[model samples]
Target: MVTPVRVVIALCLFVPFVAMLWVGSYAKTDPAFIGIPFFYWYQMAWVLISTALTMIAYQLWRRDQRGRSSRKGGVAE
Candidate 1:
């Protein structure tokens, strides 16, 4: 009963956690963006990315809950 949409939602939530956890991957500062060092800028950028991904996951979770509730003849909580 797991759907493709749910799989995509899980990926959206999982990817950012893995990316932020893998600090060594973006530890260098050679590639500065607009004068911001890679180390600082990279983490800052993920703050925004994480927020967006969380929002996406929330929306998708809501949709999935609605679907499940409808199938059970109950209102989504």
Candidate 2:
């Protein structure tokens, strides 16, 4: 049974991958941020965002595992 939490975690992982893959979307320089070009800053921002998303995914995964384990009487297998 797939849970909604798992779906949200999957989206968290998928969005960054898709965003980074679609390079042309942020390949411009007009929308500069803090003096950094769009191309450079966008990727850098995604780096931070990716780190956060990964942390969220890890925590969610751990919580899901714990839930499953408890449901099975805390058996480790």
Candidate 3:
């Protein structure tokens, strides 16, 4: 259970970072978005997504920690 959760959290944390890197490699002038280049908007969008993903990862980690603490309590008595 914890392993799967950890994998999911790791993916959530890493995917956006990889996307930002991929978008950064593209040319800015070829395709534009609302007068801004693809490079700029893509990175900006990923920044927002990254924040959300990070929040999700934090929540998952907290949940995992809580579960561990509860299990410990069960074993102690």
Give the number of the best model, judged by TM-score. 2
Quote the positional error of residue 69 for candidate 1 in Å: 1.0
Per-residue lDDT over 1-77 for candidate 1, one digit per residue giving the tens place of the 0 to 100 score: 78988998989999998998998999899799999999999899999999999899889999899989999999888
What's the best-to-worst order under lDDT? 1, 2, 3
Using all chains and alpha carbons, the TM-scores for the candidates as numbered come to 0.87, 0.90, 0.79
Give a tens-digit lDDT track for model 3, residues 4-70. 8899899999898678667547646657878987777777888899999999999998888788779
> When superposed on Cα atoms, how far off is each prediction in RMSD?
1.4, 1.3, 3.6
Which window of ten consecutive residues has the lowest lDDT sum in model 1? Answer: 1-10
Model 2 lDDT tens row, 1-77: 78998998999899999999998899899788889889999999999999999999989988888889998997535
Better of 1 and 3 by lDDT: 1
Which candidate wins on lDDT?
1
Clashes of each: 0, 0, 0
lDDT of predicted model 1? 0.92
lDDT, candidate 3, equals 0.81
